[model samples]
Target: MTFDHNPRILFLYGSLRDRSYSRLLAEEAARIIAAFGAEVRFFDPHELPIYGSVPDTHPKVQELRELSIWSEGQVWSSPELHGQISAVMKNQIDWIPLSLGAVRPTQGRTLAVMQVSGGSQSFNAVNTLRILGRWMRMFTIPNQSSVAKAYEQFHDDGTMKDSSYHDRVIDVMEELYKFTILLRGQADELCDRYSERKQKGVQESMSDIGRMVNNVNLSQM
Candidate 1:
């Protein structure tokens, strides 16, 4: 299937530091995907409040949610903190509810996870991101990147150096782009769940009953 427009992909990085490796890595991936003809955007987590600390109507929260809805796919890059995905990453995901009224912002969207570490290479952050992706009902791509000693992998200019880790990031982005192109058209059908359909039917029936009761009350009056 061909897309009439470039596949839109949203990037979320975990960190607020001046030289956050996760952000750099995400930027690198964004560049790669952009070169492959995918439209990309990033949500700056600098002012995003902790989940539930503020109303969903908060500007930053609204921005993030809007980006999630606009995206055909997403990339989550986090720094491994204490051998797990950083809270910064989790907070961003938390802001985007699984269901927003009748629209499910993330369902069936393709996801790619990546992580950076100060020490040895570790998959902890990426692993946790994959779990979160599944929980959000997204299609997590098979390829992922975990940069060991991330500080060394990138140049002073925020561009990644030529290395195996860089190669893997390129691979992951390519796969994500391909998956999004292949699935964006069919995502809704692919993610259709019997349980949700049944629930929706029940809700509609209840609404009908309520309307009927209101009509009868009006007639009696």
Candidate 2:
């Protein structure tokens, strides 16, 4: 199916460093997504503070929540730190809860994960982020990318080398596009089933109240 209407994809890069390979990787992925006709945005994590029990209205938190709500899919790029996802990536995930007030920020959305490694190609970071995607109840696609020896994989101008890693990024973005189109309209139906059940219970309770009032009138007569 055609993912028309300009499906939005939010790219979250783990490291805030000026020349972070992960950020460069994410930008490359975004370029591919745009090439395939999707609107992609890379979020700047500099303003996002650590997660806490704060309300959804907090400025940076709200901005993130808004982007998550606006997008049909996401791309998470992080450097592998100690064989796992970096702290920056984890913090961004933590800041985005399953819900923001009445809306579920991640549910019914699609995700693709990528990682940049200091050594050889490693899937550790992407794998961990996939687990987190499941935890957030997001539909994560199967295709992923892990760039090995990231320093050598990218140019000084922030464009990544045209290699197998680039091809995988293209594959993941295309897959995410396909999955997002298939799932977008179902979001409300999936979420509202719970609300429908709650509505039914509320109606039944109101009916019980009506019955009690009828019985009281009869007793008074």
Candidate 3:
């Protein structure tokens, strides 16, 4: 029997800081997710050209889009740059839209959000990301982790130091795994019913599938 081992997880980190706390938090989360049996990958948004900076043909933009399509779920991590998620993080989110040519890039995807605060702990970034996730039509998991004064939570060797915080990361990841499987199964059908266009050029194949098209009219439709 072929054992299915793949649960693709895309990790997005905010800030280009050499020692970004947000990146550290993401790394910690990635480690836990991998330990739990999912294959985790991180997005290097720095290489990604902004939404309008380069056209769709840009290598970085294409890279990001391809990654989004391939992943089962995503982990969005950002630093509280101000009282909210960093502009860099917001910019990356902005680049990921529901529509990408004929494909809806983020629609129906599952997401887990996290935040690292430079000062007193806060949920500003995660809350903002969750709102964005909803707008993108992705299913955002309810569990989340926020690391305050994140600088002191990791060691110079890049290992996470906080045990409680580590447990929260595990919780967030497990939730993402469950939601990803549950949502992907219904994604295509969900996209069809919820899409504003309705019918969306896909004529109901069966006479019984549509809004009382009736036997003869359904065939013509």
Best by TM-score: 1
Candidate 3 per-residue lDDT over residues 40-130, each given as its tens digit: 8888878776568877778877778788888878999999876888877887877777887778878888899999887888998889999
Q: Whole-model lDDT, candidate 2? A: 0.85
lDDT of 1 by residue, 1-221 (tens): 56689999999999999999999999999999999999999999999999999999999999999999999999999999999988899999999999999898999999999999999999988889999999999999999999999989999999999999999999999999999988967988998765676687766665766688777856557
Please give me the total number of clashing residue pairs in predicted model 3: 0
C-alpha RMSD by candidate, in order = 9.1, 8.6, 5.6
For residues 1-221, what per-residue lDDT tens digits would candidate 2 score against the true structure?
A: 65458888999999988899989998988888898788987778897877785665789888887888888899999999999998888988888888766788888888998999999888899889999999988888988988899999887899978888778888888898888788878866765554455577766555666688777856556
Error of 3 at 137 (Å): 0.7
The lDDT ranking, best first, is: 1, 2, 3
Please list all clashing residue pairs in model 2, or write none if there are none.
none
Residue 133 in candidate 3, Cα distance off native in Å: 0.3
- CA shift of 212, model 2, Å: 33
Number of colliding residue pairs in each model: 0, 0, 0
State the weakest 10-residue window (summed lDDT) of model 3: 202-211
Which is better, 1 or 3, measured by TM-score?
Answer: 1
Q: Residue 150, candidate 1: how far off, in angstroms?
A: 0.4
